[model samples]
Target chain A: MAIHPLRFFDVNCGIGPYYNPPPGHDPSVSALLRGMDELGIAESAVYHFQAQQYDYRVGNETLLRETAEHDRLHPALMVGPGHTGEAHSPDEVAALMRSGGARILKMFFGVQPFVPGPDPFLMAPLLDRVAERRPLLILDHADIHGVRFDWIVDILEGWPGVKVILVLPKLEYHERYFYALWERFDGFFLELAGDQTMGTLEAIVARFGPERVVYGSRYPYFTPLQTMLQVIYSEIDDEAKRKIAGGNVRSLMEDVIL
Target chain B: MNTDSGILRSALAGEPLDDVLVIDVHVHWGRWLTMNLPAAEDGIVRKMRRAGVSKACVNGILNPDVAEGNDQVASAAKRYPDEIIGFAALNPYQPRPMIDELRRCVEELGMRGLKVHQMVSAPAYSPFPIDPLDAAWTQVWEYLDARNMPVLWHGVVEEAVIARFSGIPFVMAHGLSSPATFRALARYPNFHIETASTQNTRWYMAEAVDVLGVDRVLWGTDAPLDDFAHRWGVILDSDLSEDEQRMALGGNAARLLAL
Candidate 1:
């Protein structure tokens, strides 16, 4: 096949699959990088399992070390409030970000002992702390096991700089949220991941200018071929299409590169 | 254009078109609604501008508007006529009102179609044959069949229900609960399915279209904050052909909506 220049560059892809148990070794940094190469993705803002589901310190540390080791991958450090069941001490959460390992501190509030929005649980306060630093907070906002979109938007609004990486937008509400983002916040981005709807991405690009969206393949979860094909053919202007495929994320990496 | 045949609209089969509009056939605004309530028109219009959605087919809602939500959808459709296609959110329980609104959708508001949910309309509306053979739905489909419009349905167990409604066109809402249903709809002309808001993986649905025809299935992204590229990416990423990709992107909906 003739080479397509856009396919050669993707800046920020999550490190997992479209399926729950994503494909990869337990925090295998190599598997993540290889997946990137195969998909023609030049780089990514990586999040580790330890960062997502398992214990925080070990997971965050593993992520830090792995990210430090990879050239093509960046990191989105996961955080937990101390009072929550999966609480990561503020100091620990700070260390991961302060150490300059993550650009956007990823938050999975649904798993918290404290209810998602408010309660004695530490989610609200912890988020306030992160907001202080003005870091983007990438949320796992799908109907998955139980992630709520309303709570996600509330948190995003609460913390002004918190740029939400609404992963799996195709699985979310295109009509509603597309309108909300442009009206509500100008900075946050709607990201596409897994092998979701890259075709819809093109459609969105045609309607909305291709600025607030990015290309995010939930890596390891989907093979490179699967993720790559999604962006291969688009209906938007070819230049804008490439941006949604990779450029938007490439620029976002200026921040995600943390 | 389908240069090989030159029978249908060049743009219809899988060719270039005049507009770059988008239509999301499957999506929902219900459940755990804790976020800031977006100003339906301004919010969606702004986002559409940002996400690149030219128009979206929004359907299904709850509580306050069980019977009236379709009106709100119609409002959005009217306000953003180019950007939104409001699907009537019918309550099988409130079948009379649901049908009333469905008629209004076609006659007054000019909506393209209807959307249903067993989980939402269930036992409350009337549940037995799941297929709209019930006095209410039979009439509803009968009316729809005469018009030849499509219905986007979500079932407690959607496939069997979809099978019962074979002659009428259907768009499966979720992939998880609707898998077996998709396999069945793969064959019929009056049915189409999308993987945007379904509870299953986009990869699986992409693979399913093959056993099913690529033309029979379409692509949609539940947007606002959801990724359009990601959903389309799955279809394009699949083994499906470019012609197939064109169909999924907007071709299928274009044809289905045309009728």
Candidate 2:
């Protein structure tokens, strides 16, 4: 069997010390790259687990330094509202992106102890800065139920310039909230990590176009091969497949102007 | 291994599978979440076929109507003896009744093991806190312990309780969601882990294999609730050795169920 060339961009992945990973799972850059090599993922945008779980400084720094060696690895700096100084203001965050050359921003406001904004009023200054830079801000939907997506929607509504990508979306909620959001806002994107419902990939592509979807393995936590195979073997056309596999994420990366 | 990509494509397309014997340890019949199925057994068979599953152990979680559900599972297993494996979905509230029912299920109805979802089945059956260590479950536990039957447990029962009933093989259904399950596996030889649900990520499956060895980590789908391809793919594509993959997929369950 002749294997095809690589053309995949994973938009949602993590590195550094994950708080709770599978037993004997190594969350190192080399391990991640090795897996990516096997799965044929040409590039990936990743954040560190420590940024979401503990401190962003350690995680963001580690993500930059570790991923710097590998051209295929693109660092997605973890940031939150500097309410208690765990994260930074929008200007400070943009500065980190400028210095670190980070093309993406990963947030875990729902999972971590950071306020992602019920009061968009308080967090306006930071969000305003984020809006101007227009980095692909990836947020984790902690669970199927009671994720402050409504709060997130308000934030998006307030600042349309901030391109938001949701990771780990549930099937039920995809129809309820996310599909409509993706439909209305061109800035909205969905990572394929949590899109596990059968026939959903085809359905999403058919309705929303493949451009709205990004290939995300959610590696170290998820098997990259599964989603990689999913996109490769989907019933969708080759052009649509190409867009989902790498084109969409590549475009997102190119659009990130620091 | 060179034909891995072609083999996966065949498996996904519902074509005749390769030599790999894929057995799904956790599957459910009847309704779950907000959706109701017209024919639960038929739906599962279709899913199993499409996902290239050789055999599947099913739990009909028709709670509050436990008897009806168990009967459905038992009959389904009988109807498709080679393909379907039955597990008695025991209701702890009906302890006395369940003991006789379980005996009947195993001896006459062909149920090989027990399936109990403490979170889903408990609160409706009994009142608050609904402890697994309650005296109400004593007779049933003793009965299972005597039989040396394996149970697919879906709740956070204490390691001490699992240690106490060392005779019965307890397989924790969802490896990721349960931290106590990992602890139990470490402490007790009888305790094992099943790879199921979205919580059973590739890393977790690899971890389960690392902690308990491939022989103790069983591949489960929690099917109908979860897709078989998505769940099983994690095991198929995991970094486990081919021998380890074989054991996790079916070998472990085959030995546990005497299938």
Candidate 3:
């Protein structure tokens, strides 16, 4: 470690069974905690795979029940635009977010079938409601989900209060899209699990400051040590490393209206 | 919760493995057309120092102009002979005979091995879409086989072709995606696999070790395309013993390159 052992809080983690997970990967809550401990991560904002794969209500309920006993595993419920009525109304989602103590909302536009696109007509109600709460909204990168980049721009433009964290862009050749977004939006932050292009972490810190970056493992699919070392060995200062490791996410969480 | 891995301990402590012989086999030089890289050879050396890489086997970024790319690698290797081990790049589709360029790079320019990316063989960045087993590549294979030179190939070459060139130490760059390929090539003693792709899972490297043994699995960062510490940390945190880690880190590459 450096002069101080930075505390790490993973913001992009999926817990529960995943379809065709890696050979030895355990997607259970216990496995997530064990991995965090192995990598010295203190806290995690976890969403259930059931939400992305099946019904969001069942998955959200399961996440709450499973992580209720563990204080370190913060529940991040998956939400959608209530198009099929599978998800409740916007008022109900806000109420559920408060009751469940879920300050983070995860939307999987690419993987989930209900929310096909991030068009304003589809996302406005839920996004508008969540915007009032200003919960941290974690989205898989637009490129990964096959959603157009402008759709994300629209989301950012419409919901300025919602802090969006884009996770898992390809490691190479993502600068043109991501750099432009960083320059345009102060609310946009990057979780550095998938964006490990050479000198990207240092360059991003140098240009955007450490607050615009956060730590994530994309665990089960990848090892946490991969991105952890990226942050630790980066040329940025020790304080920036600390903020990227955990402080940024902590501040984002503390800013939640819930 | 406690662990025995010193490599893991050092990496987690944010300290360089000064005592460990870490050799990154997959590094690139020169400017990439698609992405921004560090300015020059000095940038790579700075990264190596941070990651504690003893040496890197490097090649130039893929371009249609093969000789120009190889010259950049040759120049970088000459500048930092101790830290950089150059691998000559060849574009088989070039009009000039590839063997002559290979000879020039190895004999005249002092490159130790060959780096082949099929992407450069095509006009644009379309990967060598043609079957790699085609008759055109036979001459290249025969030359490397006769000299017992090592090759780091970025695209797919059938297992039969690998067995045919048994004298050459054929290292598959980003070969962890296919477990079947590993099982098929395990019979060939000269076949090796380098870990450097973005598609790798946590168990992929360990699985490679199980299939090909620790000596056949080499640690490669694909640096400048990927990050050094990110790739190094993958192996350091792998389910491998210290001896296995040592072999994957640098010992196997040293044995293959005769370093």
Best by DockQ: 3
Best by lDDT: 3
- B148-251 per-residue lDDT for model 3 (tens digits): 88899876466777878898999988776667788888899998988886444457776787888889988887877788888875576677888788888899
CA RMSD per model (angstroms): 8.7, 4.8, 2.4
Clashes of each: 52, 0, 1
Candidate 2 lDDT (Cα, whole model)?
A: 0.71
Evaluated at residue B83, the lDDT of candidate 1 is 69
Model 3 TM-score, 2 decimals: 0.94
* lDDT, each prediction: 0.56, 0.71, 0.80
Chain A fold similarity by TM-score, each prediction:
0.78, 0.91, 0.92
The TM-score leader among the candidates is 3
Model 1 CAPRI rating: incorrect
